[model samples]
Target: MNLINKKVTHKRFGMGSIVKQNDSIVEINFATDNKKFVYPDVFGEHLELHDASIAHSLHQIIQEKVLEQKEEEMKKEEEIKLQRKYQELRLGHEKLMRNHKLHPESQMVFWCDAEEQNSSLSEWKIFSGEIKSGNNKGKPNKPIRLHQNSAVLLTAVEPGRPEEDRRILGVYMVKDGFIGKLCEDGYIPAHSEYRLQLTEQESDQMLFWNYYVNEKFPQKQTWNTGKYRYFDNSWMAQILRDIVALKNDTREQEQAQQFFDHHCKMNQLIEQDLPKPNGSLMRA
Candidate 1:
């Protein structure tokens, strides 16, 4: 191939430009602090040219690459914007749900957890009771009014991770309503029990919880009083809307994957052109 001044990805050195070439050897300058010379015929196996659109002066190619990166960033920003918009719409719907009176038999419950163990929805279980009247007192004692098959949605905090890492864990159908009773051990306090059964078909794993907290439901104080928190219809409706948005963003997600794959290919070409510690060319 005609290798003079071409942008290529090296299997070892990452992205680089073919600065010079002779009858037997091709010279490449990598993005990293390395340069290499390789046999013209052998170089083809180890290096792949970038998109033909980048076939310009190194300076021009760099500029084009920067523009491409900016475009990708803009796409991500648009996704966030859409997420915020849907979140707002969900909140509004929630308010409407709250204003309307619910049937006396059914009530909605909100559940929150730190998810330190990264437990999946299937793994979650109904605990027997909580620690009684101590610093470790469990979820608050609110009136249990949920009917069988009532809705239960979960949100989780990702411990030691960024706030963005926090997400909605998904919805669970209450197989059994709150069965309030004291534990056999008096030291362990009584708690209202509910069997949270997962409905995988209706859940969204991509909806973030922190986004809702920051943009939709801002709280005045730290509200971590054990794993479960309760909310009414408005909050549940908002979560369902978020799920719908996530499911519908399939096209954007596919585009993102394509962008990421292109980036990886570029890096690999540059890396393949890197020189070894002994100042020898890496083998194809």
Candidate 2:
């Protein structure tokens, strides 16, 4: 429109000298000694652009640039939001590990289900009980002992599966005061040998084992006995180290100490309530 460096009249500002012109906007110096920038498409009718073809071309370019800018800004905002969400998730994971008192140095056992009946990893449950003194020909052997606060590296045997890989189920810390005789509690069927119980929180966490499983130990290792057992060899050690660091960072050691202290107190109380050989109450 050759409006650049030309005198023109703005509908509102009145009688202004065009100082600059670009694809998107035109800047003008008003007679009142004020400066204003106007978008051509928005104020094209209000001002004069002598060349109609030039005005149309500039308008299209301006529209395109504006759309591009909006898209770029939106992308940046999304990136920022994603980064923030990740940080929150990391913090939440650390807090969870601490609350459970999970640590790498703690003694842990690898528990797995190999039976064809228990094919689904989601249905696996750990058992604890003493085996019957005499070997019952058809009965399943029960654990002789189980302890509260025990940690286990859990897994399910995967043989001929599509992935052909054993998955590492996340670590679990046994709940406090949940250990007892399977036969006495009646929590499960009489034939079932495990008496250990997990809290609702612990049970729900198990559902997300796929998310928690250590990815570093992708390959499966086998421990062969009468049957083939598959497990992630490095998963337990790696997860322990990671959780230990999380617990320390979250300052959960103090909470852990208090838990043990209370546990000891409860044990003492139980011992005191026990009857002596002579049938007298035992001293605390």
Candidate 3:
């Protein structure tokens, strides 16, 4: 790395020997007079080193710098692209809200098994709750209220905790025109189009009781003995907004917002009409 006393040739100075080298600065004694130049920068264009080994090392360093610069530029470009897409999605959602054409019905919250959900989340990417009664008993239960574009919030009682300690596990949009099919013990998709699974830490932060406590039965959880129930769009909207706030990374936030906007547009609601992130939903 030291270039003291090394012979080098310059386009203007004719011939020179490095006299002092300090960090990036190099002073050389030339036939005409003393000259100073930035070390590797001069070597890149205006000068050439007499030592081949040192020249090779400088070449490698220059290559590395070029590569790093390119990578940083690419990263910036990607971030800009993501921002533009996020803005476009927001604009589209706002336009839909103004028109009132985005009506989504049949939204519900279902009780999901933690173990089965964990597996499906990683592998099948499907969900189903069992139907215990009626003509379709022993099959995967799809509520009559569920439809395409409907949002579903999945919940499970926290492991090692009482039923009162139930937590939300995931949120999903039922796939348009999807027919029920079996996956393990239940059905496919609930007919899902978009799905977002909460990490274990995230699940812990969102308790089911905190969001949907029964007012009449204050001591009871929202669903005491049901597979699922029709959920209000207003409540769902508020939950989606909170999910967006839960993300710390910019891309993650964008993704959450994307899902929020999709759900809002499908459900014929605007962000302003709903409660703010983490705000309580009003019950009638």
Clashes of 1: 15
- TM-score per candidate: 0.32, 0.34, 0.52
lDDT (C-alpha) at residue 147 in model 3: 45
C-alpha-based local distance difference test score of model 3: 0.69
Which pairs of residues clash in candidate 3, taking residues 3 or more apart in a chain or in different chains?
A: 102-268, 175-191, 175-192
Instruction: Name the regions of candidate 1 deviating beyond 4 angstroms.
Output: 1-120, 128-131, 134-143, 162-165, 176-221, 248-284
Best by TM-score: 3
Question: Could you give candidate 3's per-residue lDDT for residues 92-119 as a string of tens digits?
Answer: 6565435433234356777767676676
Task: Please give the lDDT score for candidate 2.
Answer: 0.42
> Residue by residue across 147-211, what tens digits does model 2's lDDT show?
34333444443466532233444344444433322224211121122122223333333322332
User: What would the TM-score be for candidate 1 when compared with the true structure?
Assistant: 0.32
**Most accurate candidate by lDDT:** 3
lDDT for model 1, on a 0 to 1 scale? 0.45
Q: Where does candidate 2 stray beyond 4 Å?
A: 1-3, 6-9, 21-48, 103-284
